[model samples]
Target chain A: MSVPFYDSGVASGLLSGILFGYVLEAAGFGSARKLTGQFSLKDWSVFKVMFTAVLVAAVGLYLLRLGGMIAGNSVYIPTLYLWAMAAGGLLIGAGFAMGGYCPGTSLVGIVSGRVDAVVFVVGMIVGTMAFAGVYEPIQGFYFAAKGPDAQRLPDLLGLPEWLILAVLIVVAIAGFVLGSRLERARGGPFTAEDVNGEDTSKAKNQNTTFNTEAGIVP
Target chain B: MTSSPRPFWPPLVAGAALGIALLISFLITGHGLGASGFVTRLSAQISGWLAPDLTTANAYFGPFLTAGAPLASWITWEVIGVLIGGYVGARTAGRSRLMVERGPQASVGQRFAFAFIGGALVGIGGRLARGCTSGLGLSGGATLAVAGFVFLAGFFIAGFVVSALVRRAWQ
Candidate 1:
């Protein structure tokens, strides 16, 4: 077959989603503890996983393009909607921290039997409906910045595309280093005792030593 | 816990593999990657089913309805892939368990509330941002889109700030 494979929409997405979910779970993204730990600066698997994936793809795709293999850019490059994106970023970030799963990861969680992840999916759906429902009122501002221009860092800042990409690569590497330092400083990854998946505050209240020997500290 | 909680793959290994997934995604569909778009359309479909007029009347949902049906999308299939793949991953790793993830200091109900609200926020944010982490951060960032960076900055800023207050959720 060709370098660019056939794109049967549903078939494509289904296979892609399966791969996506599998990779996520393998990376430990299915666990809220590992994911949420990023925010607390306790464990950095989240940063590590995200940064590594992004960097690898960014560099790989660029290389493929240079070789004239992959052809043009992705099917869709999200346009710049500054106000809307900024607002969305805040809510999404907060949700990720609080809910402990982004949309992709949440699906992974659901399959892994995490009830909270399922709940989150439900909440996100309701929230989406709410947004769609209220779109009538917010349309003016919601799409105020919407346009056809595809904004790239090079074009926006007048920098060479290669230079920007190089910088991003450098930044991702630096982030990995920082992630390692933060992980260590946080006194190693949280054991089951620290986040036993239930209210173990009672045990903490007793100030008793956590007996991991039995494997059921509570 | 059995086997002291099986360890997950190192980030470098798993992430690079994931990047390959992105590469395949591009090769197959010419699209980078995304998840929230599926949920958004699904939500609209539901809304359309119950209140077709109102859904079609709203500028946001209306435009989407014009494009045939929201039920059919590349995102839906990919998300299905995510579900099956996740099951495989969790099953192989021995990490599949039905439970609500929260800190020892919190309760199930508290976690549920937090989950719902946080999910709602992501729902709102996903639409505004035009994509979620995988969509914006991974796919968009890989493409070097300027808005991708902006969304990334905002997401991390909000996440860091909120994480401080909600430390009990994971700490």
Candidate 2:
């Protein structure tokens, strides 16, 4: 059908970001406290949403591939460079935990009116410039030990895609079950105030009664 | 044990929706999600606008210049959507807090410093790895990319370790 428009990358990028922003907003992810609370076990919304998204996408993509709607190979799967990814993740993670916002979330925070978000963003630019400055020394090592970029868990484990998808779905279900139980065990009504100080029950109820009705533990 | 009182989407529901968005992306465009790359690209544009001569001469900004589309690129528009969407989300949810988030014990200056440091690390790290948590960890992982998984694991480990070290920040 010759569907990827010449400017399609831009269109796709715009659509993708809008969808992402909607999802993040719907889930009440524009707050630093709620995000950071995930690490403290004070709130598990981030984990819940993140894992759920991964599970759904995994299952959906596998199904789409099976249906021949999307060619698995055409998708942009990154190359597996072990050291660079691990190191980069470590640094980014530290930033997330301490800063209470990742690069994306910090932008979210900015919209939510946190001055700290602006500061974090500024830091991000400086950091990027710093990376550029040192690109030469690091570039060679960063791309080193390059392995098959196509290696996925299923490929590494030599399992069928359906089986892997099934396992992931099951795991996601298990997480939901465990998370609910954990909240129940603690014994309290959940509130947006506790998570990020925003009452999302009413807002979310317009969206999903299953969660708000389920009630968060104390 | 006190149960968490914050009301938000159940993890499963939110994740599934997010996954669907990504799956839609793959089917429609043959790619996963992203954020940081565009940030770097936009930063380059700003640098260029601020200094045409230096930006053109700089080795790093060279690639983006080759692409020929300045501020009008897709990434810039997407980020604009992010701001608009985020604002809409926060306003709709009534979460528009015009305050600097810091631990009760720390001063605003101290919190700002950590945030700045942390942000810089993310900026640099995102560039080095060619993506950030969203671009690499979440989106890439969903695509079952090996690099995505590595990045995720590395990110979580680093976050958990540093969380302890910087416990006071959020405490």
TM, chain A, every candidate: 0.82, 0.80
**Whole-model Cα lDDT per candidate?**
0.80, 0.73
lDDT (tens digit, per residue) of candidate 2 on B49-76: 8777777766777677766855666666
Candidate 1 chain A: minimum summed lDDT over ten consecutive residues — where? A191-200
Candidate 2 clash figure, as a count: 14
Per-residue lDDT tens digits of candidate 1, residues A1-218?
Answer: 45667585778888878778888888888877778888888787777777777778777777887887866654457788888888888889999989988999999888878899989999999999888767777876777776447777777889976798788778778877888888777774544333332344554555476655535423
- Tell me the chain A TM-score of model 1: 0.82
Worst 10 residues of 2 chain A by lDDT: A1-10
Please give, for residues B118-166, the per-residue lDDT of candidate 1 as tens digits.
9999999998788989899888877778778888888889999999989
Location of the lowest summed lDDT over 10 successive residues in candidate 2 chain B: B1-10
| TM-score of candidate 1 against the unseen true structure | 0.89
